[model samples]
Target chain A: MYIPTYEDMLAAHERIKPHIRRTEVRTSAYLNELSGAQLFFKCENFQEPGAFKVRGASNAVFGLDDAQAAKGVATHSSGNHASCLSYAAMRRGIPCNVVMPRTAPQAKKDTVRRYGGVITECDPSTSSREATFAEVQAATGGDFVHPYNDPRVIAGQGTCSKEFMEQTDGLDMVVAPIGGGGMISGTCLTLATLAPECQVIAAEPEQADDAYRSFKAGHIIADDAPKTIADGLLVPLKDLTWHFVSGHVTEIYTASEAEIIDAMKIIWKHLRVVMEPSSAVPMACVLKNPEAFRGKRVGIVITGGNVDLDRLPWLAAS
Target chain B: MYIPTYEDMLAAHERIKPHIRRTEVRTSAYLNELSGAQLFFKCENFQEPGAFKVRGASNAVFGLDDAQAAKGVATHSSGNHASCLSYAAMRRGIPCNVVMPRTAPQAKKDTVRRYGGVITECDPSTSSREATFAEVQAATGGDFVHPYNDPRVIAGQGTCSKEFMEQTDGLDMVVAPIGGGGMISGTCLTLATLAPECQVIAAEPEQADDAYRSFKAGHIIADDAPKTIADGLLVPLKDLTWHFVSGHVTEIYTASEAEIIDAMKIIWKHLRVVMEPSSAVPMACVLKNPEAFRGKRVGIVITGGNVDLDRLPWLAAS
Candidate 1:
């Protein structure tokens, strides 16, 4: 198993600092009152690509040598990673190819295209995605950058926690929504070295709690398909991500679908930041486990702001 | 004639700096591409009270002497001003009384109460509001703070444009939505002294085109009851606001209700910020009049983020 060191994150920061925005850290007085915790929100939703995936994606794209970069970079994702990778590649003036499931939202597909990505559609299954991506790689001769399992990508995401430490003082606990364990693994990688005293917690949806089940079982347990409002957190943990999750993360908490939606609306109504359902899972954990967070200074990492405006979750029911 | 000097705005900035957030100026790549104008959005929607009115409201609340502050402050507004004034008073630990139209949305009324404002509902009419306000003042003995007509409030709004000048370089034009003209007057007050070369423009909804008509007629034209999606821009300009509007404003532009809603969706989709309909009129103007704004850098004041989430205009139509 390849373990990413703190120095890798430091180097990643130097490599991607100019390309990615050091998104603002904000506080919600109402949220603070509700949880009885001084909550500082790391707003990665404001990132140029509208997500924290840009950090990892940029690090991977820019770290490649000229000859390798000329061949271009490719990723297989149906979420923010596809657009973010494309955005990073565009910034570096490199070609980017994305293999997305045909079932992906048109908005997500449009975002990838807007960032100058060439998209190839595939069946929404793992075998089909792998086969389609392999064929595309053969045709384009592109470097394959895995969404979360790569050490370079993990190191790149570690840069976020570094900024969090610099932005706020003395965070007793840090929480992030676990979606294939990319963000949580990066948090584990950083907090382990810098502030081991600060507990690292992973939040997951109850309807799609593969990470929680894997954590409790003390091994990797892959779920074929789980349905949740948090579409981003449906993917199961990988080997490298599981390594960090098992060793460094202190706990994994889960929230119901109703709780997640309520938290999402609360952030919009009060904080007024346009974040997605995945971003609200961590907040849902904070609300559900109030005793664990009360009187503690907590940092919640807002993962992304990509949502379909027309089919908003609250409006669907109303 | 009570002309607000630039020095008063400087003073207001000093007094309210601790209380108000120095909102960030964000550039939208998509908005730039859509309008052919490099748009710099001053995001006052990020304010704690979800609006720019907090700046003026805080200035008024904090400017009061201890004896005057002891009696508290009062306003007759049905929108952001009511909640913002209450927020400012809450911060200063003083009483805030708001006489609002009973027809106002419950969400708006709830926001006022959340900030500890004592609400006295009246019939939806100028005469009824004024009459009810007088009775409330007699009962509570609160100092009446005019929403936009007061010199101190306009000076407070001026600080936003002052910050705008410092934040960006070489803006050829600055635009803001005009209602009672608090924000427009403030923009005029600051830019007239600081960047007189930069054209100051006001945008209004065609349905509620009192400001546009007032500009053409060279005097204040009060509208009895005009309906539009941009509800915050319904109020007509007062004498104090008219002074700055007639003298310093370069032009007044209007947009149809459809254009305003479209512009609002674009901001929410591309900018990923939760701003209200009133804030979208300026962007709509830039879109409709592309010839005037094309290739020029324009600063747009995003007035507020207070919206009734359940009753979204587009969702209503759907």
Candidate 2:
């Protein structure tokens, strides 16, 4: 297995600079008081596709050679990665295809279609998703972009922490929510070389704590299915992502489902940004373990803003 | 009635610079395509107090003489103005008193208290609010800062349009939600001097279309108690605000309750920002009158972000 270097991250930043948004770092005095720390939120939720996934998707799409580009790119994701990859492909005028679960939200499906991505629906199980994706990739002869495990994708995600470090000075720690470990792996890749003194922490929902358990066991632990309000963070860690997470992550924290929902409401009330449930886990972690973050300058990556408007977690019957 | 000059707006900007936020202007490709017009959103919902009311409230709180400053400031708003004024006064370490209807959302009442303002509850009636405010003023000897009917407040609100004009070039029209006409009046005051070529428009809920009626009649038409989902826009226009409204407004457009809710959902889904119902009116108007706004560059002011999270208008029983 090949490891992506800091040099690759630098090249990815240069390549994907104009294609993705340089999302601003936002702060809230109210949130500061609640957490007892000076917090800077790197608002990836403000990205064009409303997620940091755009960075990796754009990097992979733009790096393809003319011959490979003609065949386009293919991905199997039921979330932001699918729509974001589609958006990046559309920007370059290439044909893109997505294999999505039939149970995925209609809004998410519509977003992918709006970006001109052809969607092939599969059953809601993991085996079915992988089987369907294989068939589609074989038929289309397109470049396959794994959401988190690909070296190019990880290098692309590394640019987020690079920009965060440059956007603010003297960050004591950085926290991000982890699912498939894509964002956390990217943070580790950048921080390991650029600012080793700055701690990198990963947060996860307790209901879906495979990453936390994997960290404790010092090995990759796969969860076939995990139930949580944070739909984005249900996937277990892959080998490439686990390599970075196990080596560079300082700590892994977990928050309960109720606490995550409460944190989401607080962010909406104070920060005035619409964030999905998955994006609130890091804040919930910070709030729950104040001593770890107290009096520290903390940078939190707000992962995404794509949400089902009619079925907000707080509004849902729990 | 005395008019607030452009010079007064400049002075207010200078005085409130340290206290208020210079919110960024955001654009949406989806919204532009939907309306067939280039749209720029002035996101006042990102303000420190989560509303543009803080700009005016801060100006009023800071501009007081030493003697008046000792006495602090007072108001009778059941919405954003009350809490924003409290936040401004707390920043100055001055006394802030508010006379509010007891029936106002508990979240709003809590916000006022959180800012260290003393709340005086009154019956949910216009006469009761006015009468209770007079008694409180007499007892506290605080300077009364009428929410939208004061020159200082109007001048402070005018700075938003000035910043909008500087942020985005060549806006053909500026649209803002009108309640007591404070924001629309400020837009008129600034644009009438700085960008006379830009048409100024006001949007209101059809159920509480007092501003539209007053604009048509060439006189102020007071509504004692208008029922609308836009709680912040239920108040009638006053003499000072009407002066700017009658003289400078290009058009007053009204949207139905359903239309406002639809637009609010669209903004939350596409823009990924939490905006209150009143703030959604301008976008609703643009959607309803695409022909009036098509093929033009438009600026829309997002007024505030204060809402009862539990009782969203769309979730309310119809």
Candidate 3:
């Protein structure tokens, strides 16, 4: 339950420097002209494991003591985090145990295995996942690195913003999708100390607006089985994430499923980068509420690029 | 036809620097592991016009003297060149006239018009295109900038290699898709003068293997009509480009349509960058002839990113 400090983020950055990519920031003249804002896309999608989670995953893996590294790391995630953590552990020559829903896409499971991660499958329920993960961690004596809630993970994610600001002269606001708030919280953790003048904005799917509600209600509001095309953003805010979202996020903007899909297509069309629907949530929100962002320099975090090309959402029969 | 020299490329680089992006070189560890080569992808796709042609277009447009600039520029191509030239003309506040096939995709025509290019439609035949271009040029008094054959265009395209070399420590060889030979000739123009030890390899679709055959034959062998899924690489090499290809190119490789599509998908899946099928020819050739590139540092140009999301080739029903 530790609040990762600015110092922690700086240390995590140095520790994870060689393990993760300091991905390039891309700009589209067409998007800038369309949105009436100078936009810089931090393409964390270009990370070796195709996600910004690698930043945090590598930080946590590399920061572990030699004795603890020997014990290895474990996490339960069905998305980019699982593969990213496995990739980081492989780089460190340590064991990584991933607890994934048994019915999770085979492609995702294959990615985890490709990175040398051992999988413990669970029934597709939170209770089953927790129980399975607990058993695996107990059996392996592995460090349980909560995907976003762990202080080390948040600090690693915080370094993304530091690189973003360095990439651009400075951004008026930094926007990212909020699922468990790992990325947004990390952005807040860095900007609050590094560039206090910059606004931290969180974007979410309209269907899963728990973060927006929580921000308004002044408390954590967990959603049960919420669904959206932005599958990466279905999770609710945890305590560590809630702390930063409540304290530093200047706004939480939500976009409909249709809008998120449209943004994803537009980005692919113009930015020419394949990324997750969740990553487009920020662009979708900005486009919907243009007046707020016009004339401002906006940095959008394209969090991950893990996509099933065979069934691109845009190509699916509507 | 004038043969552009190394100094011409240097001047073109300076001329077009203000108008075009020094597009980044991206790498994929996954791709490197798959191909058994250290591959550097010079992402010309990230240019404002979404292709490498912008370099040539900007050079041609900006290199024009005030008197010639007032007359503006004209070209006849139904691909990226038309739109890129129009974009450059618009940047320079000059009129651009394009003679495109009337049957060209409405989307492409729309792109040219959006960039303020005036389109003069022609029948979809070489004779009709040349005649229509002549009439348009006569009526508008605009200078003709051949899509790839012009010395100015070749010189401008050569700047790509200058930047590519500067971006990487160095490369054993450079490979690019060769249709009209603008890009490959440019690479030869730069690398021959700058890094003679570096090889210049040309890649082409087997269906459009004129360049490969011509290189072997030691003379220009223009195809009457070559067709492939890589629409951008349909044109045959012109005499101006032939001079550089015959003089400096080390080897020319060809890939089947299936291989090209497979390479495009693999790159999209691993690099997470949306690029044209023609751009993937180099990777396709490399993968097919892995022994040639194994353990070597190779640079491949991802030439463009202009793709229709609704009609992605991979997603099309087989």
| lDDT of candidate 3 over A138-224, digit per residue (tens) | 999999888899899999999999999998999999999999999999999999999999999999999999999999999999886
lDDT (Cα atoms) of all candidates against the true structure: 0.92, 0.92, 0.94
Supply DockQ values for each candidate.
0.71, 0.75, 0.88
Give the Cα error of residue B310 in candidate 2, in Å. Answer: 0.9
Residue-level lDDT tens digits of model 3 in B1-318: 568889899999989999999999999888999999999999999998899999999989999999999999999999999999999999999999999999999999999999999999999988999999889999999999999999999999999999999999789999999999999989999999899999999999999888888899888887767889999999988888999999999999999989998999999999999999999999999999999999999999999999887877777763
Cα lDDT of model 2 overall? 0.92
lDDT of 1 by residue, B1-318 (tens): 577899999999999999989998888676888889889999999899999999999999999999989999999998999999999999999999999999988888999999999999999887999999999999888988888999889999999999998999758999999999999999999998899999999999999999999899987788768999998998888889999999999999999999998898888877888889999999999999999999998999999998877777767778
Candidate 2: tens digits of C-alpha lDDT, residues B130-185: 89999999999999999999999999999999999999975999999999999998
Pairs clashing within candidate 3: none
Error of 3 at B138 (Å): 1.0
In order, how many clashes per candidate? 0, 0, 0
CA lDDT, candidate 3, residue B310: 84
Chain A only: TM-score of every candidate?
Answer: 0.99, 0.98, 0.99
- Candidate 3 error regions (>4 Å): none
Give the docking tier of candidate 1.
medium
Q: Give residue A30's error in model 1 in angstroms.
A: 1.7
Which runs in model 2 stand beyond 4 Å of their true positions?
none
Better of 1 and 3 by lDDT: 3
